[model samples]
Structures are given as C-alpha cells and as structure tokens.
Target: MSFREKMLWVAFIAMIGGFGFYFLTLLTPIGQNASPDYYLGLLFFIIGLTIGSMLVATLILFIRNRSEVTFKEDERDRNIHKAATQIAYYPLLLGVWGSGALFHNGVSTSIMLNILLAVLVGAESIRLGYQIFLYRQA
Candidate 1:
C-alpha cells in the first residue's frame, strides 16, 4: 500500500477505536450522570489516546517507508482527498445544523457536545474511508 493509504488506514482504525470506546462508555449506566469532572477526564483521555496513536503509527510507517514519505501526496492522492472531503462536508453541515436545532430546543450541553463530537468523528471516518476506497480502486 502507498504511504498515504497506509496512514489513512491507521487514522481510520484509531478514530473508530478511540471514539467507539468513548461512546460505548457514555452508553453505560454510570455515564448517564452529568459529572463534569468525569466527562472531562474521559474526553481528554480519548483525545489523547486518538492523537497519540495516530502520531505513533505515523512515525512507524514513516520509518518503515522513508522514501515513500518524501514523495507523499501525488496528483491522484490530492484528487482523492478532495473528493472525499467534498463528500464528507455534507454530513458535517447537516450535523451542525441539527445540533443548532437541538440547542434551540434547549437540549442539555452534554448531549449537544456529544452530538458535535459524533458529527466530527463521522465526517472524518467518511473521508478516510472514501480515500481508502479510492486508493484501492486506483
């Protein structure tokens, strides 16, 4: 696989694993409580875990393929990224608008925050997935 594709795969897995654990934790009985400290800690942990894993994975990949790393982002890669980002934009817009509506309806801050986070994760997942698919096809 190309370096870019490999990086995308790593990002996709990291995001799903990190956020999947986060959301699952939130669904548990204990998570129903709006304890600001606990939520903040968990959020920070997940963010750290996601970013740390991505950085480490990227470093390893770069080490393993130093040559490929230097020549990253060809025309085809750029095109695929552009297409994926454009496609993912729709879900992001929808999610933001929906979150605004929820806010107007006086939803809890925690719920709105989760919704926004979910939207961001979903958009990123879509972008990475589409790029991977395009990479494989090409």
Candidate 2:
C-alpha cells in the first residue's frame, strides 16, 4: 500500500479508537458521576492516545518506505479526494443543522456534543474509506 493509504488507515484506526475510548469512559460506572478531575484526566488521555497513535503510525510508515514518505498525491488521488469530500459534505452540513435544532429544542449540551462528534467521526471514516477505494482503483 502507498504511504498515503497507510496514513489514512492509521488515522481511521486512531479516530475509531479515540471514539471508543471516549464512549467507554463516558459509560463507566464512575464515569456517570465523574468529577471535573476525572473529565480532565480523560481529556488528557484522549489527547495522548491521538498523538501517540499518529506518531507510531507515521514512524512505521517511514521505516517501511522512506522514499514514499515524500510522495505527493497524483491526479487520481486528487480526484478521489474531491469526490469523497463532496460525498461527506452534505451529511456534515445536515448534521450541523440538526444539532442546532436539537439544541433549540432543549437538548442538553452534552448530548449535542456527542451528536456532533459522532457525525464528524462517521463522515471522516466514510471519506477515508472512499479515498482508500479510489487509491486501490488507481
């Protein structure tokens, strides 16, 4: 696989892991009544995981294919990305509007935050998968 493809996979995994961790923490027995300190710790944990995962993924890619690290996307990659972005954009827009409506309808801030995060992660995963598909085609 190309370095870019590897990067996308890494990002996809990291994002999924992050989402899982966030939800798990939120669902913990103690997490239900988690203190401010608990939330702060969870926040830091997530940040650490995100940074660490990206670093590890990049390091692996560089070690495996140093030359490919510098490679830029060609026309096909660009076209695929453009198409993926187009596909991802509409739902994202609608999500934002829906979230706003929920807030207007008295939804809790926490719920709204979760909704936004879910939308973002879902859209990104779709885009990444679409990009991978295009890369494979090329």
Candidate 3:
C-alpha cells in the first residue's frame, strides 16, 4: 500500500475515534446541560490529537521506510481529493446556515457550537470515506 493509503486508514480511525468521543461526551451531563467549557474542550482535544497523531504517524512512517515515503500526489489522488472535497462543501455551507439560524433563534452557544463541530465531523467523514473508496479502486 502507498503511504497515502495507509495514512488514510490512520485518519479514518482517528476520525471515527473522535466522533465516537464526541457523541459519548455529548451524552454526558455536560452535553445535557450544554456546557460550553466541556464541549469546547473536547473539541479542542480531538482536533489536537488528530493533528498530533497524523504528524507523529507520518514521522514514524518516514523512519520506518525512508525510501518509500512519496509525498507527492498523482493526478488520481488529486482528483479524488478535489471531488471528495466538493462533495463535502454542501454540508459545510448548510452547517454555516444552520449555525446562523441557531444564532438568530437565540439558541445556546453550546448547542450552536456542537452543530458546527458536527458539521466538521460530517465533512471529514465524507472526505475520508470517499478517499478510501477511491484508493481501494486503484
């Protein structure tokens, strides 16, 4: 497998783990009360861990296989990414609109932020899934 494919698998696992933690956190009393501090902290933690892990994983991959570490994407990879990103764009736009609606409706900041975070997760899931699909096809 190419490094990109392996990285996609890593990213997929990370995203799934993050989303699971998100929903799990939301089911807690903090989520019930819409505690902005707790929810936002979790969001930050997930983002940090995802980024940190990817970087670490890349470093590890490079260390393990110094010769096979190809960083450049071919045309297919670029097309797959562009298409997947285009697919994810609608959810983001809708999420922004939903966030605005929540604000206009006087919804709690916690809830609005949760929705925004959900949007991020949804977009990421789509992108990762599509990328994996394309990778599998190749």
Model 2 misplaced regions, further than 4 Å? 35-37
Whole-model Cα lDDT of every candidate shown, in order: 0.92, 0.82, 0.82
Write the residue-wise lDDT of candidate 1 on 1-138 in tens digits. Answer: 988889999999999999999988888989877586788899999999999999999999989999888885678888999999999999999999999999999998988999999999999999999999999999
Pairs with backbone N, CA or C atoms under 3 Å apart (clashes), candidate 3: none
Q: Where is the poorest 10-residue window by lDDT in model 3?
A: 30-39
TM-score of model 3 (CA atoms):
0.83
Order the candidates by lDDT, highest first — what do you get?
A: 1, 2, 3
Give one clash count per candidate, in the order shown. 0, 0, 0
Model 1 misplacement above 4 A: none
TM-score of each: 0.95, 0.85, 0.83
Model 2 — TM-score against the truth?
A: 0.85
Off by over 4 Å in 3: none
Residue 96 of model 3 has an lDDT of 89
Candidate 3 C-alpha RMSD relative to the actual structure = 2.1
